[model samples]
Target: MDTIDREEVDEVCALAEAGQQDYDARFELSRMLLEPIEDEASDSKMIACCKGCDHCCHLRIEAYEFELDSIHAYYLRELNSEQQAKIKEAIVERYPIVKDLGDQEQRSINVRCPFLIDSQCSIYPVRPMSCAGYNSCDDSLCKRSNDDPNDTSFGIPQDQNIGYMKMRQMALVQMALDLSFEEEREIISGMHRRLFG
Candidate 1:
């Protein structure tokens, strides 16, 4: 796995500081920080995730406030009224059940992501780090997990640097927290707040 260099981390921190109020800069920084994880996943042959493979899309999609802001921008600027209405409908259907639940509970809700269209992420380019971080070598495990929420078979290999990715996520969250950004929120609630608030 490629270790993120200290210099890179510092650069990301600088970007986060400067871009706290700049949505595009913050979004770009998020993607840059995530590049190493993607590279490592590719190196390990564990990055089998692709469009139309929407198993993980059913899992809770968590996002930082800035990331949610990016998605909301895409939602307003890109989606047609009908598309937006359909997503809002999905949220209306599922948000009630998952809204008060904790993060882990939200993940087990088994609802397709509101932004999933024809089994592809409608906001792929600006997807949150949480969504971007989830990579699995085994498609079967993804299927099983999607089929049975209780099944523990769904897992990415340890060699994929999940721990490293998680640590990087925490660092980013801490940076955001220091800047008074909301820690994180599940996709449905986050989007609802972004769209309606």
Candidate 2:
């Protein structure tokens, strides 16, 4: 894919080789893979995702199996005991209802992400690729979409080179899968499992 840089590809493979146990290393690789997509989207003015604009945070977000492990590692390493407990409590409270909702329906629901703390993504640097890929050129459109989930007509101007970005995202996830076994689960449910342990 035109979006896949040879060096970044090599880095992903290297990170995979470093293994899932090295959570920090894997996170570094995720950040590297995401940086280009963010840059390209920003350069194209396609990214209107900003702090305090959490309309999209309610959407269902999934992670590569390895990425989920990384998130758990992040929580343990970065969050205080109280913060961790709070996240767990939120997941326990919300995941059951969310587990039954269809993807689009879940997106329309007003439930905030378990990881969203005070209108900001608490795990932003290592957030899921699905979350990273989301973009909007206009904040109003996002708000409208949130307000009226049935209106699927709302859309943002995506970067023209989205194919490349998609390829990169697939490459990163596939590489992680090759290195570890993980089944895809809804974000809250997955986090609940992780936090429970």
Q: Which residue runs of candidate 1 sit more than 4 Å off their true CA positions?
A: 1-23, 153-159, 169-182
lDDT of 1 by residue, 1-197 (tens): 34446676577677767676676676677667566556665666445676689888888777777667778877877789988899999888877877898867765657788999888888777777777777777777778888888766446444447547756665655653453224677889888877667
> lDDT for every model?
0.72, 0.72
**Model 1, residue 123: displacement in angstroms?**
0.9
Best model per TM-score: 2
| Alpha-carbon lDDT of model 2 | 0.72
Determine which window of 10 residues in candidate 1 has minimal summed lDDT.
173-182
On the 0 to 100 scale, the lDDT of residue 52 in model 2 is: 90
**Where does candidate 2 have its weakest 10-residue lDDT segment?**
175-184
- Which portions of model 2 miss their true places by more than 4 Å? 1-10, 108-110, 162-164, 175-184
After the best TM-score superposition of candidate 1, give how far the Cα of residue 49 lies from its true spot, in angstroms. Answer: 2.0
Per-residue alpha-carbon lDDT of candidate 2 for residues 92-196, written as tens digits (9 for 90 to 100): 889788878866678666577888888888887878767777777788887887787768775655455653674567665565445321345678877877766
Error of 1 at 89 (Å): 2.1
